[model samples]
Target chain A: MATLGNSTNIFWHECPVGKLERQRLLKQKGCVVWITGLSGSGKSTLACSLNRELYTRGKLSYVLDGDNLRHGLNKDLGFKAEDRTENIRRVGEVAKLFADAGLICIASLISPYRKDRDACRAMLADENFIEVFMNMPLELCEARDSKGLYKLARAGKIKGFTGIDDPYEPPLNCEIEIQQKDGVCPTPGDMAGEVVSYLEGKGYLHYQ
Target chain B: MATLGNSTNIFWHECPVGKLERQRLLKQKGCVVWITGLSGSGKSTLACSLNRELYTRGKLSYVLDGDNLRHGLNKDLGFKAEDRTENIRRVGEVAKLFADAGLICIASLISPYRKDRDACRAMLADENFIEVFMNMPLELCEARDSKGLYKLARAGKIKGFTGIDDPYEPPLNCEIEIQQKDGVCPTPGDMAGEVVSYLEGKGYLHYQ
Candidate 1:
């Protein structure tokens, strides 16, 4: 972990309006739906579907996909270990900000490191961070190979590929897990409904 | 300027629902109100006030203040020229995301460098980035010294303080300027109203 520098001569300006007020105004509680998986595991698809579903229901939500972030906020980062950690760290921080603004932030990333995901959870309140694990088998993902990444990894064109040369640490106690059964992948709509149901069941989708 | 690394083997996943759709659903056009000024010039105050004003008017909005960001996303950054530029860069990207999510994003920071601010403007579309300059004189800010930062800078306790030792290159062609006249600063409500009026005039607050 890198040492965080202390900011001197800086003071926090207290906002007259807070997260609670914003949540009330928005008619929903702020939270982060962190979706973690390997490539071709349908993380981005599920995330985008959930975002659209929430929008249809008049709930404000946004998806922060890894690929889209790499073009903007995380463009300086690479696929190296340290850069990956920093990338996740920055995404987690940004998701925290979105949640603080009283929006449901859906973050889709191949955050293979347990410690990095745990750090993100620690950054938010317990109920605000919901970890959704996409437990698709590596073989299934390789066969799907939506982006041909697995084929390239197999051909030695890519290094540090998760679930290939690199390791993926599955979540021990994820809030929701979308798993494959009998080599059948869940539809994006079904996965999105499961997430929305989880939020609704936990009373996080609406304000009293 | 540092060159952004090209993301190899990374492809952007287009969302089924785009920014225009989100803005239409929210019944408002998305935009970023970038407020720049020296420390103690009431940038955060104005930003918060504008947020509250927008909320009361049935508009979704968020404020990205420098103080709040330092505690989270930019905690590793220090008070150096390069670090400050990076800090503003990240904030601009976040603001762009917020706007893309169909919300009015008010970003308040002491972005003293013209080039850095210009780069932020270039990240977004022409009409989406509205730069608001808090044209408060350095002497007034030093006299107010709400955070005592000016005193520290005067005593040589703080290095590279904007307007003390460092340079503050004001915006060449900002959309709006809130200048203090005769040592009398605009009231927070009045300033907030001014920003709201600007947005209304530009047909951004409500959907046509």
Candidate 2:
């Protein structure tokens, strides 16, 4: 009898079709590319670009951005601190499932805290979790404010907003970082290519 | 400004790589084969067997049994009525994500409530949700008593057990029904073959 959290008497069910076979079928290794940054730091843009690039290369990939999940899977959750942690936990578990299904899961979120992000990393074994930091400066992101969220936060309309009212803890040892080049941001395609090349070099592009 | 539940001003991130393209890459249609049954009715066995069969045919699939999910995504839930409902809801949402990721998502659960199961069915659009009912007799499940759960339920050690104290509402119009033929239980491979045959007939075995 195995117990997990509040669940007792649970057993691990081993299926005959495991990850190796799935990778062979999809012709690519399963993994999670976690993109973390502030609201306007281009995390979702990088996720979308990476997904499109991988698809063009005949590689299977899926994006799990806040826009898709906050309404569906995490609908009951609010912007409170506890709810935010639970939100990240659930997304991490779901991303693990997508990786097990032999798809490159790209999770983009304004995951401001390092502890929550590290907890997600611990869920995946070995090097399956690849953290990509959108290392754009606060000033640059605030300047863009594409969604006007920064403006609202600065006006005290949105409480606990990341990089404005709340803290945005940067990753100390992320695998990849996407930042501006000489005060100029790189094109989406270029940033995506950078990640794709990393995946290729790491042998995540093939089943082996 | 879009609002969904407690989430306000959320946007839908539309990635270039979508379900159709993912299906084309996997060479099969993405769907959920939800196996519902009482305890000891061989739902997990059928799931494992089906997964193996799909593997032999060179198709991508993943199993989302309680053993895998209850300890992960749904760990925050419990055995209470409200927790059970939330558990099923989260599973339904995760199964939707798996389907969208272009895999044969096999979700094996003893979801005894009709409302909960129907709620899950509504989550998936069109014929994507294939409900497979394990219509075994209660007596048969009680006799098998796999995991000794039936004995525990009978002894009142386990409260609100399905088919014992709690209800096990059957599916009115599920896509497939697996039960003993002539009072003889089908072998696991035979049962898996039935589901595989259904998928093959439905053109789910190929990417159109």
Least accurate 10 contiguous residues by lDDT in model 1 chain B: B1-10
Residue-by-residue lDDT tens digits, candidate 1, B3-76:
35846777878888878887877788999999999988889889989988988887888889887788889998
Give a tens-digit lDDT track for model 2, residues A1-208.
Answer: 6677877767788887788888988889999999999888898899989999999999999999976798789999888899889999999999999898888999999888999999999999859999999999899899999988888888888899988889989999999999888889999999999999999999999977
Q: For model 1, which pairs clash? A: none
lDDT tens string, model 2, B1-208? Answer: 5777877657788888899999998899999999999988999999999999999998888899965688899987777888888988898898898888888899999998999999989999859899999999999999988788889888998888889999999999999999999999999999999999999999888998
Leading candidate by DockQ: 2
- Model 1 DockQ reads 0.65
Could you tell me the lDDT of residue A89 within candidate 1?
97
What are the lDDT scores of the predictions, listed in order?
0.89, 0.90
lDDT of 1 by residue, A19-131 (tens): 88888877899999999999988899899899999989888888998888988999988889999999999999999989998989999999999999999999999889999
Predicted structure with the largest lDDT when compared to the true one: 2
Residue-level error in angstroms, candidate 1, position A4: 5.9
Docking verdict class for candidate 2: medium
